[model samples]
Target: MITLDARKEKVGDLLRVSFQTQIKFFLSNTKTKAAKSVIYNYIDIFTKDVEIINLMKEYEAQTNKKLAITLPSEEVPSRDAWVNSSIIFDSRT
Candidate 1:
């Protein structure tokens, strides 16, 4: 049987790989400079979220126990960020 920790680790790895692939695809295929800029900013924000990183580490440390993750109450990238991203995405299609 696969252990819970192993399963979690695999899922995390899969998500990271998936995001990386998507980012690469967008960067390569996105024609406009503005769209690429938005994607780059999103990547920067994601990588700099220390709270999320800490939460992940905590969860990894307590894999065997049932732990409730209380995400940071404050939104990371605010609604404005999504609006910009959405506009960029929409422009591509």
Candidate 2:
């Protein structure tokens, strides 16, 4: 359920875009003091997982570009890092 609004690209007719997708914190740890504010009001931080696509096409032709980005973990939060890398082990049911 991700929606990207591309209304900011007024660059070349050969379209270009830069985007960094983010995961917002809503309904946070309601049982913990640490996330009180995040639970009360919607909270958000940025992440680079958001995929951006750019295409350059003549009005009736197909065109494309490779959209590769870097998501260095040191630059993102580690709070829930385990959720993304718990695939290597078949232990602990």
Candidate 3:
């Protein structure tokens, strides 16, 4: 059987975007019905910066998910720290 490299899996950006979008949707819909909205859970996020880790905690509190954001020893800060640092994201984009 041919084996693919697991290290090549770079889906952090995708997961982060999905998580932010879903949480935003749930919060915005509070005026109407939020129970129907999906609260993402069991998400595993890997990062290095402590700031991002804290931010993820806030997101977790809002979504109440079993999300896990790990900080690998070899991980480095994201290139676009300014934008990626913020948890508030526009769902339109």
- What overall lDDT goes with each candidate model? 0.43, 0.24, 0.42
Model 2, C-alpha of 27: deviation from truth (Å): 32
**Which order, best to worst by TM-score?**
1, 3, 2
Query: Best-fitting candidate, measured by TM-score?
Result: 1
Best candidate (score: lDDT): 1
> What global local distance difference test value does model 2 have?
0.24
lDDT of 3 by residue, 66-90 (tens): 4543445585655333233333334
Of the pair 1 and 3, which is ahead by TM-score?
1
RMSD of 3: 12.2
Q: What is candidate 1's TM-score against the reference?
A: 0.33
Off by over 4 Å in 3: 1-9, 31-93
Worst 10 residues of 2 by lDDT: 51-60
What is the number of residue pairs that collide in model 1? Answer: 0
| 8 Cα displacement, candidate 3 (Å) | 4.5
Better of 1 and 2 by TM-score: 1
Which ranges of candidate 1 are over 4 A from the true structure? 1-3, 31-93
Which pairs of residues collide in model 2?
Answer: none
| lDDT (tens digit, per residue) of candidate 1 on 27-89 | 356433433343344444343244434433433444443333343657455423333455334
Clash totals, every prediction: 0, 0, 0
lDDT of residue 52 for candidate 1 = 36
